[model samples]
Target: MSVDFEAARLASGTPDELAKATEAAIATARGGIERFKKATGDAAELLDIFDEANAALGNLRELAGMIAKAHPDKAVRDAADEAEQELDKVATDISLDREVYEALAAIDVSGLDAATRHWVAKTLREFRRAGVDRDDATRARVRELQEELVGIGQDFDRNIRSDTRTATLPPSALAGLPDDYVRAHPPGEDGLVRVTTEYPDVIPFLTYATDAGAREQLWRLFQLRGHPDNIEVLDRLIERRHELATLLGYPSWAQYVTENKMIGSADAAGDFIDRIAAVAADRLRADLATLLERKRADDPAATAVDPWDNSFLQDRVKAERFAFDSQAMRPYFEYGRVKAGLMDLTERLFGVSFTRRQDAPVWHPDVEAYDVSRGGELIGRIFLDMHPRADKYNHAAMFTMVNGKAGVRIPECALLCNLPQPGDDPALLQHDEVSTFFHEFGHLVHHIFAGHTRWSGMGGISTEWDFVEAPSQLLEEWTLDAPTLATFAVHYKTGEPIPAQMVEKLRAAEEFGKGIFVRQQMFYAAVSLELYRRDPQTFDVAELKRELQARYAPFPEVPGTWFHLSFGHLDGYSAIYYTYMWSLVIAKDLFTVFKREGLLDEETAARYRDAVLAPGGSAPAAELVRKFLGRDYTFDAYQAWLNS
Candidate 1:
């Protein structure tokens, strides 16, 4: 049923009155759970109670907002806000019941009888981690802290959205940039390129443009955005993280994050990073030497490689060696074809199908929704938003809107992408974009395949942050395989398959900038680690960045460029930036399994689905991975992949 804003407003009582109603509703919902435990109701009946509680929380939350809006008095609004908080506490408290929590944990997991038991066990652990067994006072504190966290995270993102500064440059500064790139820049009637911190205008100008001066100017504008005031925001976020972790009884935020991940502890996570870093470091240096040699060849006057020069030089080298430009490949990777290929891949691997639905609500005009099914059984739905728009999130991500529950409905997800539009020029996706689409589709398949049998909290993307990237990252490997690319990457104009020579060039050029690319990531992780490892007050972010760059990046670190100030991951990743690399080690090793078994081997794919993705966070990631591979997740495997 659709939520009726007008009806909700009319039904909403005064702050005090609505607070009482909400509390009563929560108690009723909790009572339903008790009755189910007493054997007075079945699993389905208990789920209805859970839904009722969810609805009550949604209603109370909405009512609180309406009351606050309708009231003129600040005191009344504050009271309404308090009422909302109380409702949240009640809902959270209900969900925290140890018996109720354990009962429905993995009830009907994914239409498979075995999955239910796994889900319950996983759910019980989640409750323990969430402090379900804590004393009332501790539980109350947890509720308050959770609300505070929600507010702080939203504030952090809001600050990023609102803080837009501009760098005005002369019209001559735009020379050598594409016509569209120059025109997109807000022109002062006097004729200057007004560059903001937006990606669409900045990225293209930085990468393909022949004008070195213009590229450097736009690069400075993009990086320097995290300056002055942004430093304070970053500091505040870091401080807040430290406080929250300490409050939660973890020694550091890293411990809290790693505890829930595949590595199982901070020490293990560190070891994993160190292992891959060692293997990748020497190879990276070799790669960097090649890039430098190429750079020297281009201009004997080029003394040092800077960040701005990295992408431009890399792209240039790619074209020279590969005879394959990503831009050239983009036209063949039509959004529809890329999407269809992903669906076909899923069907091959997991026996799922996706059909577009006409009557679905989407946030944007370009957004489309699909009904996903298995053997004609309705499993789940997914929404895809693939075109860039003003003020839209620029990165690709899959957001899980619902999670499966036993005796309850399955989950759905939204895959948000900022792809190029099909306009005057035909739309094409670069190989990286194709990989991104596959990566995100992996997440959707993981969530959608869960199919009605687990604690909602433990389903889909709720797994360990480090392990969370495994499904998506593993899928990225398929985008590189020649056979896999043949399924989709067709030329738009000629309808010819990607030529074999072009494929060879692409593979040959893949190692072109290994040193800079790998070390840049290492530098990012080190910088992030330094930011979190030190006290916020003592932190000089710029100095830390300089040290990190000197060690990892061959280029000298530019002063006054506080790039990390705009790093959104700092608010979320904190000390966990290393997790991405750690996960990649797992991904590369896992891809080796697929390669060994034949890339499209159904038996191996089925094993992966059953053991890894479909189980979600039901089993420990390490255990699941070990079970799937029939061996331990050894660092040696990762080192072998990296060195090879």
Candidate 2:
């Protein structure tokens, strides 16, 4: 079970070595500033300076922080944590540098290419936002606020990471859960099954467990994650963020966060969600009505379906109404085969190939490395870490260590997921789990294929956070498509493809609970927005959540649950949980092109890669979308998705 942290140890050198690297990066950026002052006469020379700054401030810092957060060894994580502070200091210094700002702003960008002009514009805007153009006193305050935010955010994340909550239930309490799950999780000396809130445990029990009381117990425990400690951390963070936003001339932190996003403003994001809800209310009502009816059938005296009953009830409904459900699809989706099939499909769709490298050095034995290639030439390397472990980051995400640049060195990234571990049988993924695999893999492909920027700053997943999720969301549609699923969903035991009837049922059941789904997303987005707009001095997050939930959601607020405390997104995502829905709107639209062109159309895929993925963040996101779609992005796709 032990992992070798040798890679992290090497990448995260000793404290002195880390400080030296930070100083070196700063020195290099300083030299770049001088280069820019001298070379303002030519666009190419100015771009050279900007690229050097990106390497020093962007690439180096990004790499260091990634190791600090994800490296398995405690010693490596601590060392990397120290390096992250040094990296952040160097970055903060560059962002607030008046000399760099002046040099960049003075450049003649009129004759420069589109990408170069955009780079210059973005660089200037960042400097201004960081208060480099402000008075000396204001700039000092800005620096102080930024540093405080770094510490607060780190503490909040640490509390969530260290939170250890478990539910101990008797063998009979786990009745409806999969047999493999029972075998994998043995009872302790006290003779009870210990269930942790990791996705692998929580999701299955919520979906399949027959004991309603046990479900409620687990749900309540899960909701209290990061509580008592993170609540105070979050309150302080809100205050600091509000101060920073007002300092930057924004009315609220929400406006500050959304100003540069595709959504343009917080009000617009709120209105967008509200509009979707208006259209979806009917669907939401119907979904809940169906669940309530099923609940009554089970217990006629039951007044209402509890929050914990949704997943369990939905699974039963799907089985009876659609003739299939997540568990039924598991055999065709054994994790290893699903991954291999994903690689095969990528080869056909994108003209790229991935070959596994067993000898590669990885942080954990569970991690698998691959070389992404095109026609036998290396394009990038991806490390996949897709199993659960103690203290591992529980969510599914892609972590990029190096950005890929065409004609330069290949990029390096790792895909992290806390999926079910192999038991007596190989791990069989639920259909949704398979969808997640494709989703995270989409990000890896985007980072690798899209690494064509002069600035590593804008390479890989460096696009606007709102826009970054689009590529991955678009990929999720592929996993749902019957033809695409056919490429992977073969039974692990029988070696037979998933039955046509089952695939049809899966597709048919897609709309069963979408209304409730949309409403929940709306409530989350609204909460994030209101959090920033309210006065943190006496802001009642619990009250705001209750109001938002009652207004936007179909279900009433549950008593005694502090859901926001467990919301990890509050620290990282903040006023942008709305981005998920926002990006999905665009994602659904993007998939339409593939739908029309044929999902496996090699020529269209080639064009898409070159236009959307290859340019990376060199072009504006809107411009990239325009090129790929031959028109402006629209909400029609989302409306269609909702109506379906």
Candidate 3:
């Protein structure tokens, strides 16, 4: 039977309806667990029952979390949050159940296919990690820690989403911003302009606004989000994670989390961070010198660039040195055109088609839905929640609604982003926003294409945690390709294709900020890793953050601003923020084949889809890369790109 996108419980609009649906799902999952405990059947049959139960619970958890993050009504969001907490408690119980673990372990998997064998082995190992074999007291404590971690995580996210600080300034503060941006934010009756900490407001203001004091004010407000409250929340989070890790026989949460990932250990992740930092040190010095030089042109006494000045200076340098003004590209990136052009580009490259489903149920009016198909066979569904709303998630990500299991269910996902909303004026986007759209779409397509795995656990983008970002990062390269940009990058008014010279200049200008950009990423990665590696009770997070910022970044840390309080990844990604760079290294290597052939080459694209993305987590991530490259991936491509 085909999946009914509208029938999904996440579409429920009222809090009561959603709450009842969640309860029903929980009851059904519990019933399935009971069946699993008493079933007498072959290994395959028993495993199917186990996977089916888990898949149902997993899907409900994902949907509830999405609603918690994106739903418009406060009551519904609250209900979703409650549903998620309940679902997590059930999941934790299942993971710690001895009868379920022993039943699965006794199954004879020797005669099964490689994928099934892999699924069984990995499940058993995870069971062990859950402390299923421990004494009753230890197991009970593990469950408590896991459940508490969920609430702590939700609190961290809630504080950031709820606190949107705004800076009110005179009209002159809008001088260096684009005409469209100024039009979008006209002054109030008080004749003062206001900008919020949201991305749609803060990013452009930071990159273009000429008022140094105003920029610093906004930057400080942005950094101070979730402060004071999240400070204590984060401390509790780290302490609980450390306690959980020690209970599981690991020294720290970093070691516990990384043991299953491609990087393999906390020390290995740390070394990788240091290695990348060392390679970029020379470039960091050079980049900072340029920024300081440009700053001196305005303020002769200035010796260092402040955090607020980084973006403005980088944009200035790019325009002056490469003859590329990012503002010029904005007119061509009207939200509607960019959306259509992206779908068209993917259709040509991946041999898939997207048909808009206007009648599909959505949580908000701004969201658009589409059905994906290949050779006329419907494969998946996607929803684009591209614009921001109050109390919504403040970042871009792909959230899964349904995990595709062959012959059982089709994949469903959504892209939740906070780009500019179009109303009276054309909603033009910054070049980097265009890149972000492509990057998130890359994740959507990867999930759809890989969703057909035989086992539920192996379906969708379930690759090693550290390697999951590669395919999406690799797609960002397409945005910079001249031919690719020309396909959709036409001016909204004149309908003129973006000038080739402009594209050339943009690419050249993009290279100028590599060193500083990379080092900034390293600083974030170090903060994530070291925070989890240290003893939560003794170490001062602020001191550790200040030291890492100075060690890895060009700009000095702003005093009295606690950015770590708002670092959301510390909850979700925990110790693996290093995955972004690690995945980029592999992404650069994967792009080589396309560079050698052509960006739009169908044969090459098909091969890449089959080798790298199709297997999902059915195989180790390293093996997938080796299959595509005919050898192991290396940092050569990454280093060369960094230097270029």
Best candidate, lDDT-wise? 3
lDDT of 3 at 13: 72
Q: Name the lDDT of candidate 2.
A: 0.79
Candidate 3: residue 396 Cα off by (Å): 0.7
**Model 1, residue 453: what's the lDDT?**
41
What candidate 3 gets wrong by more than 4 Å, as runs, is 6-9
TM-score winner between 1 and 3, please give it. 3
How many pairs in model 2 have backbone atoms within 3 A of each other, for residues 3 or more apart or on separate chains, i.e. clashes? 0
Q: Kindly give the number of clashing pairs for every candidate.
A: 3, 0, 0
Model 1, CA-based lDDT: 0.65
Kindly list the per-residue Cα lDDT of model 3 for residues 547-610, writing each as its tens digit. Answer: 9998987677888998998899999999999999999999999999999999989899999998
TM-score of each: 0.81, 0.95, 0.99
**Residue 426 C-alpha lDDT in model 1:** 58
**What's the residue-level lDDT of 567 in candidate 1?**
69
Cα lDDT, all candidates: 0.65, 0.79, 0.90
* Candidate 1, backbone clash total: 3
Q: Give one digit per residue, the lDDT tens place, for model 1 in 226-331.
A: 4555666666666666555665677766666667666676667566555555656788767666666767886887766677877777777788766768566666
The window of 10 residues in a row where model 1 has the poorest summed lDDT is 1-10
